[model samples]
Target chain A: MTARPVLSAPPAIERHTISILVDNEPGVLARVIGLFSGRGYNIESLTVAEVDRDATLSRITIVTTGTPMIIEQIKAQLGRLVPVHRVHDLTMEGPFVERETALVKVAGTGEKRVEALRLADVFKARVVDATITSFVFEITGQGEELDRFIGLMAELGLVGVSRTGVVAMSRGPGGI
Target chain B: MSAATSETSLTGADIVLKALRDQGVEVIFGYPGGAVLPIYDALFQQNDIRHILVRHEQAALHAAEGYARSTGKVGVVLVTSGPGATNAVTGLADALMDSIPIVCLSGQVATHLIGNDAFQECDTTGITRPCTKHNYLVKDVNNLARTLHEAFYVAKNGRPGPVVIDIPKDVQFAEGTYRSPADSMPKSYRPQVKPDLNRVEEAIDLLAKAKRPIFYVGGGVINAGPVASQLLTQFVRMTGYPCTTTLMGLGAFPASDRQWLGMLGMHGTYEANLAMHGCDVMVCIGARFDDRVTGKVSEFSPNSVKIHVDIDPSSINKNVRVDVPIVGDAAHVLEDMIRIWKARGKQPDKAALAQWWEQIEFWRARDCLRYEKTSKVIKPQFALERLRAAISGRDDVFITTEVGQHQMWAAQFLPFDRPNHWMTSGGLGTMGYGLPAAIGAQVAHPDALCIDVAGEASILMNIQEMATALQYRLPVKVFILNNQYMGMVRQWQELLHGGRYSESYSEALPDFVKLADAFGGVGLRATEVGQVDDVINEMISIRRPVIVDMCVDPKENCFPMIPGGRAHNEMLLGPDEKVENATPEDGMVLV
Candidate 1:
């Protein structure tokens, strides 16, 4: 008898940024989101916007984390949705760019406000609004970079924050 | 002015009927209400499309499913809004799981009153989105004809499933320009029907060289139409490989063939399950590796190099990772594989195949289907065997089954020789599916014998359908194996839960014989072994709808079970039978 192959270990859980192109119609986004929530798939972040007015096409970017098998299931399931035209896993498809924009509001005195501005400057954030006691800094960067900027501002008397989810694009001439 | 030119200036309700006629929808199963009165009036004005009024909206969908499965046509359903649409949810889910092609048209409140929590209003499209293949909410009369055609196209194409189209009352009253299906075909929802020849060639190579090979077929073959089943029979016969079918795929391959290895799964035959576990090359055609078929997924078919062919791209690699995955219609792929295999002219290893057959024969000799005989009371298996004998030579017989021990026993004992003859809710395991489905099948085949193999508990779930059968003069038989309990549930509790019989027992059961009489149908009863055959004959001879209540042994349990979390080889043949490959450390996992 031949030696039996050993059972492989469970696949690693890693985040994947998937982009989907779908018909821009009512209930299309709900169908995409319902699939993730119904199947118990973890959705870390999501962003959607109409991409083409003539074609009535919309692009949706979803950040999800799971094992390799689960990731395959997510993409396949998304592809089966009638309105969805294409699904591309940016993480697996070579180089890609992902960016998120966050508005950081800080309410503090002299030192904390000055420190917040310094860190925002390092993170390439722009002060969109300013008052005597607070400033709303709009920062656009990769999620990790924004996390670092938000972390520094949290200790500097950060009051509120609003962040857009990740939106991704493949780093090539091709488009979805 | 004429039928051909009547397309222009037609009400939305008239457009619905015209689209159904264009799609060749001969009959629809539905229950009408206030919101659907306009459509019902249009239905009354038409003679081409017949509507069967079921007692409940759920039965309408199931009946439609039966009609679809039996005739290879899209089943049409029409029901009202709110409670009518909600009631059809279970049937929609059932059709989705079984891949039955169904187009359910549900009436909704006026478009203006949709979100106002108006009387008899519900979000039918939103509620059915996850279950249906696709759904549409038609607010405009102009889009009604196109949406109706699209609903039919989506329901029956590729991997077939149920679709819902919610039409508001206002839209039904508005005049619209009706378009033909040819002009209104869906542009964006095209599914790939042709498979890559490279993958087909790869699969042929594996089949040619395999020492121990088996064909695992599923319901997709039947859904692909009878031509697919014919090609499957031809391909499997040409290769001379052993074959086993899933519960939903009972009639795709002739069960009487020498190569047949009965049904394979939890309560499958010992030879079939063991062959699946031990085969070196496993070719899965049109069947997903569902959890019930693959116990403890990681250890399932561990040694087999698998080839899976399914039409749905999403279905591939969902449960079990396969070596060769071909996405295409079953018939299309099978035709290609046969051609490629014939051109290559490669054969399996003869000596190794002989040894494999010898091993299979050894396992088959165990006769795991044998149960202890009892003349005092009717055993469910024995009753099924008698029923099979009674209908052995009948060529126009179709069987539908509810979910329970009776369904498993029917699968084990009943042998189907042709495609579309066996209809059962396999994936969803719905209890009330059989009777309504039988009504639907009877509607399709007016003179054919349609019988529903049901249990005492399950028969009660859709007992109201008996009135539907009587009203339609369907003459469908309801064969009830009256165990006086939810037999499967009670058995599971007895074996797995330390004999703690919960609410599984049917405490206040109706007298089925009298109930049949109450429904203005013939009622037959068989309480002992001697009367079983006589009762079956009498029931079959009756020209009216009949219910045969065969009192069976209450404690009889379906056997040859690979228990939850157990491997294929680790089967429990019967209650007293020894557990194969029993390990003390092997935990009992709850399903």
Candidate 2:
């Protein structure tokens, strides 16, 4: 029996963004989640939307991290499931753009409030909802930027956060 | 309208009954409640559909599941909303886990009162969402026809599961254009189920790489038919691995094959469980790793790489972890695995494979099934053997079983050379399933001999179906293993549970022969070992519903009990591997 090589992370493991095309209908999302859940595999972030004009199909982008072995399993299993037209492991194929939009709110006063706004501006976060005592910042970009914004706000009185989850795609790609 | 069938204006109930008739649905097991009363009223006018009113809503559903399993038809059940639908939950969930096809129709409390939680208004659609293959909360009365068509479509298609259609009371009573749809829709309703080449290759790689690989088989094999038996045997031979089957997957692997491990879980083979837990790689085919199979889920196959192949998506990770999960039909996937395996020019090492085979054979012999066969008035094995001899291969005969010692004996002793050979309540172990299921089976295959091998106490559950069977002229032969006690319970009392005898005695059975005559069918009692053949022949000669109240030595228990959680090789056969009990000529004795 050939031993499976367990590759070590080069200093740090990276999360690759993935996008998939699947038939849009009832139970489609459940099927996708089921594939992840059945194998004890984890899905870091997920989002699905009915993207086809005729209402017959949808596009789902998921963000997850693992060693190359796990990622291959994920792609292969996803491709084998019914109604899944294609599975594109964007991480392995080429460069890919990953984005997430989150609504972050912080309640504080004085220097803490000032610190929150300062951090939001640096991250290009928009203030969608605001009051004298609180500010709800809408941030759009990579997951790391959102994480940093949330972390700083947590110390400066982060109240609540609503994330639109992750939506990813291959950068200049043939459709998969 | 579906991409296949044309749209019709007939009311949903009209369309449903007509669709069922078109599919050759002979009988329906159901309960009538406020919401579903309208459908029942319409059913009254339809002579083609004979509906059996069960005492409990759950029984209606279970009886339908039994019916489907015994006869291989899409079992039909109808009930009212709220409690009526909820009561059927256990049965539906059982069918879901076992992959039995059942179409559940529950009456909704009218659309206007839906979310308001009106009187007896339950969101059956939501309640059965997870358990059903697909469920519909019918909103458009216009689309009711299509919805009913699709409900059957999903339930019977791909991996066979329960499907519930929540028809509002108004819609059931409403009038519309209804036309019978063809049985051909399930073909396209599901995606092409043929296996993908790469996934099969990966599975083959896992098979080839592992030193100890085990194939876990379940009811999915039954779904694949004769091809499953041959295909799986080929796969087993190719991979040179041992196999374990679920209670429902009994006949998928040939009993005569040494590599075949007996049914796993609760009453599963100890060797199979050990192999499952110890194997480096496990290929689970046509099975969901049920809680029973993986008792302490955390401790189940902890170090093994697992692959799951099933048609249902919910089954993928609902329980055990999967390394490679393939969603497709069993036969198709097996075929693909075979083709791709051959394409790779791979061959299993015969010497090494045969060595693996020897270990399984050792376990099999250690846990061999044997009864103390002597001059017994009725031995469970003798009954099984005689029944096996009597049934003609040219004729299609179906057997249904009630759970307990008798059920286990049937599962183990019956020689089913093929798949879908025996139907019993494997998951729930319900006692009263046999008779009703037999009636339903008779309804499905009108020409077949529908037999329910039941224990005396267990037979009483749904015993009222005897009248229903007679009313329909269904030739259901009920063989009652009259041990004069709750045999399994009594055995536990005798062996493990401190001999409590807690309501295990039979103070309730009437003169069964008189009872049978009373019910308008032939009845006979077997008090002598030599009488078994004649009694069975007379029952067959009667060519109608008959009851054989067999008086077996209640103490002659089904031996070789493998205690729960014990290793397979460890067994509690009769003392010193001997049967020293009193002979059957000793006659009936009161404990």
Find the candidate with the highest DockQ and give its number. Answer: 1
True A-B contacts kept by model 2: 0.00
Worst lDDT window (10 residues) for model 1 chain B? B578-587
Over A1-176, each residue of candidate 2 has an lDDT whose tens digit, in order, gives 44644755453456767788887756678777866776667789899998886847789998877655566667766764445677787888888778899999899999999988988889889989989999999999988888988888889998899999988776784666
Off by over 4 Å in 1: A1-8, B1-7, B578-589
Q: Top model by lDDT, which number?
A: 1
Docking class of 1: medium
Candidate 1: tens digits of C-alpha lDDT, residues B1-591 = 254674578898999998899898999999999899999999999799999999999999999999998899999999999999999999999999999999999999999999999999999999998889999999999999899988898999988999999999999999988887877777578788899999999999999999999999999999999999999999999988899999988889999898899999999999999999999999999999998898877789899999999988878899999999999999999999889988998777889888999999999998989897997799989999988999998879999999999999999999898999999999999999999999999999999999999999998999999999999999999999999989889877766666789999899889989999999999999999999999999988888999999999998888988777778998888879654323222335545
How well is each residue in A96-156 modelled by candidate 1, as lDDT tens digits? Answer: 9999999989888898888888888888899999999899999998999888888888799
lDDT of 2 by residue, B406-448 (tens): 8877776665556655778876567787887777677767777
Error of 2 at B175 (Å): 5.6
Instruction: Provide the DockQ value for model 1.
Output: 0.66
